[model samples]
Target: MTLQFSGWLPGGPTRPTTARRCELAGGEGAVVRYDERADSLDFAPDTGPHPHGLAVVTARDGHWCLTNLHAEDTYFVENMESGGEFVKVAPRRRDIPIPFELARLILPVPRGAGMVKVFGPEPHYLAPSALSGSAANWPRLDEDCMYFRVLVALCEPQLRGCPPGAVPTVAEVIERLGDGRPAYRISRAAVNHHIDYLAMHKLRVGEWAGAADGKRSYWKREAVVAMALRSGLVGEQHLRMLPSRRVTARQGPGPSRLPAPPPRSRR
Candidate 1:
């Protein structure tokens, strides 16, 4: 469909000024509004998770429309000028939530030359700098950043035999995870819920050194360490991933690295 852009500015022509019009060739020519201030193109309100979403890209060649079928990762690329639709998409990556991913793609695209748009799920109105913050960029991709880090924090200390079996309950885990560092405001119930989920799957979270008298869930003092070690989610290299506050004050900036052995005299 032919998209006509008209605008009237200060000291402009008397007749209706026709800005460059772009042809929309894809799925359906969705009636869309671009909120420049908000930097979002949305078709509906934040009602809930729905299928209808649209994103726009502009280029010297013309405008292109993007559409998606929630059933799968495949999206249709519409050639606005020819009204031809072709599907071109990599498999929907697990790391990318289709809706939030729009920001990652939108920003890097070279402006004044070409544009590409994407739509799906709830609307995310983000600016070019959305990548600056941790949450926006997802520093921890697939893993549950909350508990996973707490578990990783325990690794060095527990391996070194420093105050073994410290945190026994969800509340205690929360305390140690917070202690002095900024924390993810997680609750006991949430921890318990996730513990139950892990247990239901019979996932081994490494060997727990703490006594298992009567706790219903498998999340013991060393459960996080066990999980990290066994699943290879967190390693010694990831010690820096731990929060500063989680590190015991006595431990300095963080846990100490095991000192290397003396070199052989013959060498």
Candidate 2:
């Protein structure tokens, strides 16, 4: 599992221009300080010492905790996956559990406000028997199908620890699903068809979100991604299906493993 943090350093008058990122494995801890003498990630000025400092964060298998080391400011961890849900870590609080699978750590800084993008690990699944018989009536998706490949491609950016706003376009989805296979080809129409099939037939997003065809392509992509990620339909494990060249070409590191999906079972 991985825990990544992104912070902004002072750069200009209006907004912080420089960004500093740090990564830690499970069981690792680091101090987010802002001074010339500070260690780990230092969001100090381009020159001398700055009083802006004091925050500690630790990582675990699936979640992380933040300690507000500053004596005055209370830190806020906003759950980016959810709609504006946030939790506050009181001043001097230690190891407050953060429940967001994807989050933003907000800090009051010399600039108007400093933000850190926090990426948590994929969620853990409950025991198979816990809800074994209850899923019979639910909409079913086959991971080995071509349509499923399109869904995974659409959600790749977020699944690979990028922001949720990075939903791929239809052309992008076609490129991702191409993967250089023999005689494998997908067109824009084919991709849109797959997405439409997913939104209306498989997931039944129309009941509340209305028809997918009426909305713009951007809205349809976002709706599909939101529903898929929220329901744990596509995740980090499925990212292997994406081509490695394109996968690592993304901002952060891709998953360490890229094994092909198990051979599709004969129906």
Candidate 3:
């Protein structure tokens, strides 16, 4: 939930002089305030859905603090005597997935110390240069860089789930294609294409006969099996054989057989 990065200070036997603190608020989006002189950053308890996720603050007493808004504990500055350096904190907003259009808008801004509030029914851009005699060494908008970083972080889980060793069966591929559809449609060419894609990816293929239409070739649960194994959703041994217990019941009964009659002849 929290990550810490530390390194030896660049200067010899001296602390890094260029330390700045910024407080970020997240609601509809993020608002950043620089040069905060407060000893501790103030934030409402994260009771609502839009809780703060990251904060960077430098105390007036010469201590730098970085807090993971996702975590509820105070992270302390330890081993300061050894010239330890804290991680550089960035003003970031979450929940709002950065869009390509928005990234385009921010890339042109000049770089320097400033505040950005990106919430409301519509976004508002404010710069110190526009206010008065503010020097323009502003922070470079670099929206593309930020956008890509955020996008990768958000999509990495889905990409990582699709490991080379994890392949989908024809049925699974069809199911995925039909995810938003009311029902799935299976066809010979579709199945073949799905199988070919899996084979190219070095995924194993399995097939079974359809119970309704015996001529149709049904796919085994290779996709689910692979994902379950790769993601630790199920144990590795489960991949070797079908599960002994079912998670759900089908509409029909099991293999039909004549029930044994009681010894009614005794009556």
Candidate 4:
């Protein structure tokens, strides 16, 4: 892939609220579906690659759920991108990481699919500590807050798929930071110090947005992606590239416009 580092300006919201991809027929093609009501997309396989294969369906909720063979793994959908007949397919992984303040995952849609939904609501979450005090009481403020926010953000909408909250939750953070360690005892003051250190050096929070209309407004993740591109924080080629038609143009090769080479001294 050609990795370009051009920055993108923050643009107003675009259509298709949620994008999704599903592995079809054993990873051949994916069916991408966006739902305005759910503010998300549903991906399924279009063909059966094997008599039995695994299909992954990812939603806007930031979770990937698996579909079994006996289940309805394949589906038919019309292409919004192309005014063609409906096709059967599954979603494919473009594996693009769209950077926000942090990296947000971006899934690719099939070539023919277009905006399926518009103007969907943003994802919501309840504070993690609202459920339990165990991890909530952890002393390290920054780590605790970041971990709490990420876990809560991932789990809140999928409560039915998850278990009841636990104080010291068995979340990914615990495993990543090493579970059952006394590091959580690090004091709030120390956590603040680390945050300040990061701010002074590496981590930056830019382009603040004010809340209006009784709605909590924050910078769109795309803004951060644009900033990263502009600053060369991440390569532009990493952004999901949609298929496009080639522009027709006529041009001819031209000789270099340069000063004539210096005459060689003859012996």
Candidate 5:
């Protein structure tokens, strides 16, 4: 796996958004440095290294780590793909393991922030059975089931070509599934059950049994959505399972209502 780092560099114009990878002759990974002299100057030139002076970053085993060398300021590493999830590294912290596949390291400058973007290798999973006959190593799911409909609702925003962001909450999922169809009206408990079924039974995402109840719900949904999209378990074509967005009058109705299109013409 390779690592790429992009931000401020010495003797060149700063490009905060452009990305470049480390290409050293030897197999030894590159040790990139951020010092107040150059990197911080891009954000705050006059302040004398109060919050950020130096940091060292390196990659190992498909993950990245950072060492904060300042005396009193704390630094933040954010998971850019997850919705506002971040970890804090205190002053003089050494080799803080960063678990994000894509991360943004934020150093507090005087009036602004110095940012370094880290792009790690994309995550890898075992190929499906058709490719390598490894069916036992992968999760098996039935796409025709109702649980899949719940997942499609969670992924609707992303499948519709919207920006990558938060998955729908339980209430939102219920609303999307209901869509003026009384037969599909689901209770909050049932929705939670379906999400847990996907995460625990089918996906085996992580150790959710020990996490706090409040945090478990949030992380479980995020993990399932991320894994589903990454593993090709769900896609835009499955959106047909959800109720149609069109509003048409029922056969003998006085009010317009949203309903699932006929199965023959759903596409």
Candidate 6:
């Protein structure tokens, strides 16, 4: 068997977001899935000779480690470009790092999505689809805050796990960020423009509204939020930045350090 990719790999660096293969740890690697049921990464064996060795890392922990099933280990051929949590997979051969041939054979699943599928000798774990990865897609900051805000609205509430909140409409976004009572508010029309921006800049934006039967159409919202969370755009900490939690911090009075000044001169 060989790798089968969705063919969503990027060629080189893309603006606002860089796309160097070697930039992030073995960033040149392909995206793979994490099988929660097997507790192992899913890898489909290929016809070509395997590479020198496999390098693995995990999001469960930020640590990187190596394990070799054979002494032929020389290079680390694993791909990490997808930025998902990495898991160690034993290499069939130990000569080169992950072989380039595997690139075509490996299908990219969403990084850290915890997808599960049971099939091969090893149960097939579900992975996020290639569309789940959008390292090359960058939103225009100044012009697309609305879009970014949309992602924040759709994604931030239940970043890692589902939290209490509704799928906010564009009106809520416009009012929340717009500071509706203030002069610098955003208009509903502008919010529409930004939603359009999500199609290209955000991962899984379009999928939310058109999901299959019974699944929450809002799954796309979760998908994009998870993507944003993984990619570092809007994190758990950023949730406080939301308008609902708009409390200003106050500094308490401190101890006196200097002597009290003489009564003010009647100058």
Candidate topping TM-score = 2
TM-score of every prediction relative to native: 0.28, 0.54, 0.19, 0.19, 0.44, 0.32
Top lDDT hit:
2
lDDT of 5 at 36: 38
Question: Local distance difference test, per candidate?
Answer: 0.39, 0.69, 0.29, 0.30, 0.66, 0.40
For 1-267, candidate 4 gives per-residue lDDT tens digits of 011111111242344433343322212333333343654445444444524333323232322222223243343332222211233444442222211211111222232222222111123567987775555421222433443233222222122212212112224323323323466433434433433333223333232313222252222222222233234333323222211224558888889899999999999
* Candidate 3 lDDT trough over 10 residues, lowest sum: 100-109
Q: What is the lDDT of residue 183 in candidate 6?
A: 78
Model 3 misses residue 128 by how many Å? 17
How accurate locally is residue 219 in candidate 3, as Cα lDDT from 0 to 100? 31
Q: In candidate 5, what are the lDDT values of residues 168-215, reduced to their tens digit? A: 999999999999677969999998998889888898776543443566
> Tens digits of per-residue lDDT for model 3 on 149-217?
222222222333332334444444444444435454445465565344432332332232122232433
lDDT of 1 by residue, 184-213 (tens): 555777666555444333344333434445
TM-score-best of 1 and 4: 1
Q: Rank the candidates by TM-score, best first.
A: 2, 5, 6, 1, 4, 3
lDDT of 6 by residue, 118-215 (tens): 11111234575634554655443442444766666665435533322444566666667755457757776776666555543545455543543436
Model 5 ranges off by over 4 Å: 1-54, 58-65, 71-74, 78-90, 95-102, 110-113, 119-138, 152-167, 176-193, 203-207, 211-267
How big is the positional error of residue 181 in model 6, measured in Å on the Cα after superposition? 1.8
Candidate 2 yields a Cα-based lDDT of 0.69
- What candidate 4 gets wrong by more than 4 Å, as runs, is 1-178, 206-267
Clashing pairs in 3: 111-137, 111-138, 111-139, 111-140, 112-137, 112-138, 112-139
Question: Candidate 3: deviation at residue 108, Å?
Answer: 40
